[model samples]
Structures are given as structure tokens and as C-alpha cells.
Target: MKPRISMITLGVANMAKAIDFYQNGLGFPRHGEGEQVAFFNLNGSWLGLYPKDALAEDAMVDSNASGFNAFSLAHNVGSEAEVEQVIQQAINAGATVTKTPRPTDWGGYSGYFKDPDGHLWEVAHNPHFWIGPEDTPK
Candidate 1:
């Protein structure tokens, strides 16, 4: 089994609003025109949005689950300033700021925000590690 995540799908209660927030708000390049689902090209991976109820039904799980899911999606950037920039972008896009960008104990800077559906996301800058191409240095 290859160790790679090809996509991350978010089960959204409002598909149109979700699409707008991701596409128009965050400036994610969208792919396809399917009415039931929205897909965004994330450079190497993909971000998908699907109806919450349908997603739960497809997984054969109860859709009544609420509150924190105990997980967060992170976007790593190249610098501390970029961390704040990305967080601000999320804010302008209707995300609720959960944590303002600040220096971390791990010798980095990070922040958190919740999307319209309450999906937690972290924007971080790690000086010790870079997740992009090997030729690119942080």
C-alpha cells in the first residue's frame, strides 16, 4: 500500500455554499461540473465536498454525529508570515478563527480556523521541515 493521501473529502450540509467558500473565497481551482459534488485541485492532491447526509449514508454511519471530530487538516507554508496570511485568507472566506497565528513551542508558527461546516484547519510554518518539492528550500 502506497503511503499517500490522494484526496480529502468534507461532508458539507450546504453544497452550494461550500463550493462558493472553497472556490470563490479561498481561490481553489475547481475541477468538473458535477452538481452533487465539488472537487478542487490542490496541486498534488484533491479536496472534495459532498453532501453530509449522503456521505454518511454511503459510509453506513449515523449522520447525527456532532461536535469536534478530534481531527484537523493542516496547510504548511514556507514562512511565519505566510502562516498568518493563509489564516487571514481563511477568515475573509467566512472561516471562524479558532487561533490567531503565533509562534509555536515546536519552533514554528501556526494558527487554526473552522470552516463554515466547523471543519478545523491549521495553517503552519515549520522552519525545520518543508513539505514541498525537494529542490525547493524553505
Candidate 2:
């Protein structure tokens, strides 16, 4: 329920390649990355890269087939329990659960779902980050 976006993630095909493009080619500072995704701090939020098709699936739409799959957005909270709570809230609000909450190798707890419009959203708690209200997009 923040008034502004806390993070924005882009679904990409290749994680390493996306990382290289953002970290090297674009000179963006990446904080963490793995086989599945890559994230970069952008002002007060984040930019993420994930597999395109997988993202579509998360949104419950066929990537091979199509209509408008609205953009997936994120809202970060302060704790892991908050992540779980938000996921539940999302579900009760009519979002579909795409992935169960779990511990991640990048040292955080996270879960995924799709909004009413079928946009993918991730509720996560990254201990390494200290995203505050001051972290607003420029």
C-alpha cells in the first residue's frame, strides 16, 4: 500500500546475458543474480530479468498465444513474514498464486503471483537491501 512503485522487474529470456547487458553494456550496478533472474537497483526500486515465457506462464497466459498481459509490478515490505502476508493479501484480492513462498539462494524469502489483470508480481524480502521511502524514482 505504498503510494509509489517499490520495484519493477522485466521478464527476460537469458539471465546471464541480461546481467551482462545491464551490468557491463549499460553500466548498471547489479546486486544479485542467478540462473533464474537478475536484479539491479534503480534509484529507490529495482529492475529484474526473468525468462519471457516463464513470466507469461506466471501471469497465467500462454506466451505462445496472446492478448494483453499487463505489466507485473512489485511492492517491497520490511520482513519475510510481510512477504507471506502480502502474497496472501494478493490472493484474497483475486490474484493467482504462481509460486509458493520459499527461501532463495540469493539470501532472501520470496513468492510470486499474478494480479487480477494477469500481471506477474513478486513479493520478496531481500535482507541485503535497505529500500526506504526515500528511494523514489528520479
Write one digit per residue (lDDT tens) for candidate 1, span 1-138: 968899999999999989989998889999998659999999789999999999999999999999999999999899998898888888899999999999999999999999999999999999988677564544
Give the residue spans of candidate 2 off by over 4 A.
Answer: 1-71, 134-138
Question: For model 2, which pairs clash?
Answer: 12-50, 44-135
Top lDDT hit? 1
The candidate that achieves the highest TM-score relative to the unseen native structure: 1
lDDT of 2 by residue, 56-137 (tens): 8899976675555655555566888988887887665556889888998999888888653356777888888846676544
- Number of clashing pairs per prediction, in order: 0, 2
Estimate candidate 2's alpha-carbon lDDT, on a 0 to 1 scale.
0.71
Displacement of the residue 14 alpha carbon in candidate 1, Å: 0.4
